[model samples]
Target: MVRYLAGFPTPFASPANAIPANYAPNYQYLANPSEAGSLIWTLNMELTPIYAIAPEGPYANLIYDRLINALAGQLLQRPIPENFAGGINGDAYQQARTTFSNNFVSRVSIPGYLTGKTVTLFSGQVVPVITPQLRGLYAWHTEILVENAIATAPEEDIARLTDALTGFLDRIFFDLRNFGTSSADRALNYAATNAFQTASVLRQATGQGMQLDTIDVDRSPFCRMDSDCWDVRITFFDPENNRRARRVYRFTIDVSDAMPVTVGDVRSWPIS
Candidate 1:
């Protein structure tokens, strides 16, 4: 059940480095053998195979290394307190260590081209295939990300902002979960992970006593030549004012290539 990269046969045997030259012949062994040398790297959301990762390009070996290290619980590193000692606040240290350890591989941001091709895994479940962009691959801890996002917030606003941002992210991860294949889905996923715009929007809305009401992604009517663009809207509403119009913030993201990017500045206005 829990096997190391060493357990996999050759081609996959040397997991510490470059892609094996013999990887092509082992296509049949992969969960999705649709492409030569494409290995199935399952991206799980709480044990559910959300997408099958097919790391491409010259840095495929690096991608595999990250995934394998994450699986082995070696991807995250937390510095021990300088004052740490045996039996001297050891319980607190242990608790902190446990919490940090549990967060390993809890959240991963993989920006990739979600292909139309689908593959059936060994478990018989079908999932979309994605060729990851090397620069966008990030294995993160949700708590750390949240902390970083709110690190500069005023002390008085930190508590509420933390709650609002955390809740918003939870909704994306659970309620609006998707297969990451559609352009809109890919754009939305990219926006959420990138977090700069979303975090700014969340902070602004929460500061004004508004709640994150809905997140919507739709194909953008405006697009540059040969580019696939989508608009992601995050709306917030005042619970106290039932008749008041909602505030909506929208941004355009282009998913035309392997890596998606925000096309322009985020725009916001009130909408009924």
Candidate 2:
């Protein structure tokens, strides 16, 4: 049912930009939980709600451009915990909200949303407020909070974005290590491009096929195998014929000399 509704793609900003490019809340909080639940839950990206009410199409983006420009200096930075109720400035943000409300109803792909819709957002729960028109329902807002916590001296938001990607890369590499079976091939699947010192044992997919379930990154000191690395969940097809067989791989990457994790070209394995 929710699938019938549209989702606004979260926007991303360049690292070099001095001010946030979007009015969407500008910071991210990656959780390093004390316990491991499932994969997706562990890898969620935190957010402070970014409230906007607009119609889609030419006007949707235009309104955001206006709004961001309206709050130029305040665009990007860490979200204040107290501001979870919504934007910090009542007058300014309310103005932007009103601007969206007044303008969108008549625009192309406009949402039938009420004048003052309350939009709530969290890590995995950014829902769109929309009503279907003859043209079908469409997303109303796309203004992503480009991350609010910014400092001229702090680690750039772009770096956090990079960390987000690399962290996932680390997860993928973490998964690929146990990708295949040993009887199928005693050899491991450690690619030359992988930065981890531990050569992951790769295996072959036998019996039942397996799904590349989910990638979970462990950020806490107790759960993580390394002091400052990851305890990642990886899956593989095993001799038991289970479709969801998995393993946990751990590696600590030194930040001072860290390199981007790269996935190598897939090649035919040496059959045992």
In each prediction, how many residue pairs overlap at the backbone (N, C-alpha, C within less than 3 A)? Answer: 0, 16
lDDT of 2: 0.29
Per-residue accuracy of model 2 over 72-188 as CA lDDT, tens digit each: 222323433233223455444454344443223210122133334444443555533432122212222211211221112145334544333334345543444331222111112
Name the lDDT of candidate 1: 0.71
User: Which 10-residue window in model 1 sums to the lowest lDDT?
Assistant: 20-29
Off by over 4 Å in 1: 6-40, 74-103, 113-122, 126-129
User: Where does candidate 2 stray beyond 4 Å?
Assistant: 1-200, 204-211, 220-227, 237-245, 256-272
For all predicted structures, in order, the TM-scores are 0.74, 0.19
lDDT scores for all predictions?
0.71, 0.29
lDDT per residue for candidate 1 within 1-272, as digits (tens), equals: 22323122232232234432212111122332232234467788778998888877788767766665455443333424432333235554465465555545567877777677899998899988887777777777676678788888889988897898788888888898877767888887887687656778888898788998999998999899999999999999999997988999999999988778899899999998
Cα error, residue 237 of model 1, in Å, equals 0.8
